[model samples]
Target: MTYCVGLSVDQGLIFMSDSRTNAGVDNISVVSKMKVWEVPGERFLCLLSAGNLATTQATISLLDERGLAPAERNPSILTQPSMFQTAKLVGETVKEVISYTTPAGQSADAMFSGSFILGGQIKGGKPRIFLIYPQGNFIEAGADNPFFQIGEHKYGRPIIIRTYDPKMSLEECAKLLLVSFDSTIRSNLSVGLPIDMQFYEADSLKAGYKRRFDKNDPYYQTISEGWSDALKSAFDALPPFER
Candidate 1:
């Protein structure tokens, strides 16, 4: 299992994903679930994946290969004219992977199913974020729903839902994501650390700050401990019910 999140804020977009996968309790491994593509002043795109490992890796590998080949030879995300088209391309690619990997006599939605959170901006368009399903369909982040999460998301969603503010700065958004991720890691053994995070400033058409937070990172340690203490204090401060 894994945990990945993408946020659409006024200033730009933020993406975070844990780097943990497991076949069993004893077969755990670390593998990045985030893929980034940038074209300097032209475009910037990030993909956060979750679900079957082979399915997600194959989908990302296909995108990477097409991105490096001639546009006439294959469909490449870099060739898309808008973020919406880019998302459609990703959705189609994901569906194609699911089909190609499904064994004979098995459904396409078998154990190899996967999902992705796509976010970025194209030269002539505003920034956007999308959640693409294995069925080749997707939905965009909007005013009412300015964020999306894939994988072991339930453990971390409450914090985001309760505190997310569209006007928050990109830095604040990053901090918020760390808290969300920290919450998730504590609750789900399948979602381990060495998180990969990326930010994209609106209209910049370039990638912003990127970082990795391992178990020993000082700031991450501080946030993890601080959040726990804060939560405990908040809980203790609540008035008790009358008997």
Candidate 2:
């Protein structure tokens, strides 16, 4: 399992995903779940994936190899003009991967199947965010749901629901993401350390402010520890529900 989150604010998009994959408690491994692509001034795309590791990696490789169209048989993400089209292409790719792995004619509704959050901007267009499903379809972020999360989402969602504001500064957005991920790390054993965070300022044309945070990173330590203490204090101050 993994935890990945993406925030869409007026300023732009912030995405992060942990690098943990495990078959069992004894067979844990690290693999990045974030995929980034850029065409400088032309376009920039970021993908956060959560599901079967094999399926996610296969879909990413397929995206890189054939982008928007996969050899005429599969749709491509690159050739799509809008982020919306690109998402469909990704969803198609995901569905194809699932088809390849499952028994012929069986429904691809495997419990640990597929899901992805796709966000990016085209040269002449405003930024957009899409949540692509296993069925090769998607839904964009709306005003009420300015964020999309996959994998170990529950542990961190409340923090986002309480603090997310469309008008917040990018700095605050970043801090909130840290707090969100920290919440997940504390509660889940499947979602482990070494996180990748990517921030894109709207209309920048190129991706900027990408960072990797692992166990030894000092600032990451500060953010994680500090947020924990803050949450504890806030809890202490809350009125009791039980008499």
Candidate 3:
């Protein structure tokens, strides 16, 4: 399992994902779940994936090949005129990957499973965000819903709700994501470290800030330990319940 989130902020978009994937309790490994594709000033796209590792990898590989579609006018990710078109390309890719991997006679639920968070911008458009479902359809982030999450989402959602403000600056967006990720890591072993994060400033049409936070990173360590202590101290400082 993994934890991935994409935030639709005023400045642009913030994406972060944990890298851990496991076939069983003992069969665990780290694989990058976040992907980026760019064309300098024209287009920039990033994908955050969660579900069956093999299927997701296949989808990413296919997207990397460019123009797998037969239609001459079907704009590929790199050539799409808008972020919405880019999302349709990704959604179609998901459908293809699942079709190629799902075994005959197996139920859809039992066959392939995965989802993606697609966010980025094209030269003439504003940054946009979409959450693609296992069935190859999606919904975009809106004013009421400014973010999307995939895999092990429940544990970390509260932090987002409490701290998220659509108008917050890009740096604050990054900080909020890290705080939310920190909460997820402590609560679930399936979601491990060496997290991948990318921040895209609106209308930049170029990838701006990118980072990776690992297990031994000093600042991450401080945040984790300090937050734990602060929570315990707060609990203890609260007035005792009626007795």
Q: Best by TM-score, which number?
A: 1
Tens digits of lDDT, candidate 3, 4-103: 9999888889999999998776989989999998889888899999999877888887777644545443335677778787788888988988887775
Q: Compose the digit string of candidate 2's lDDT tens values, residues 88-174.
A: 789988999987788655454445487999999988788888888887888899799999999889999998999999998777887
**lDDT measured at residue 63 in model 2 versus the true structure, 0 to 100:** 85
Which candidate, 2 or 3, would have the higher lDDT against the true structure?
3
Model 3 — which ten-residue stretch has the worst lDDT? Answer: 66-75
- For all predicted structures, in order, the TM-scores are 0.93, 0.89, 0.90
Residue 139 lDDT in model 1? Answer: 98
- List lDDT for all candidates, in order: 0.91, 0.86, 0.87
Q: Give the candidate number with the greatest lDDT.
A: 1
Cα TM-score of candidate 2: 0.89
Cα deviation of 142 in candidate 3 (Å)?
0.9
- Clashing residue pairs in candidate 2 are 67-77, 68-76, 68-77, 68-78, 69-76, 91-136
lDDT of 1: 0.91
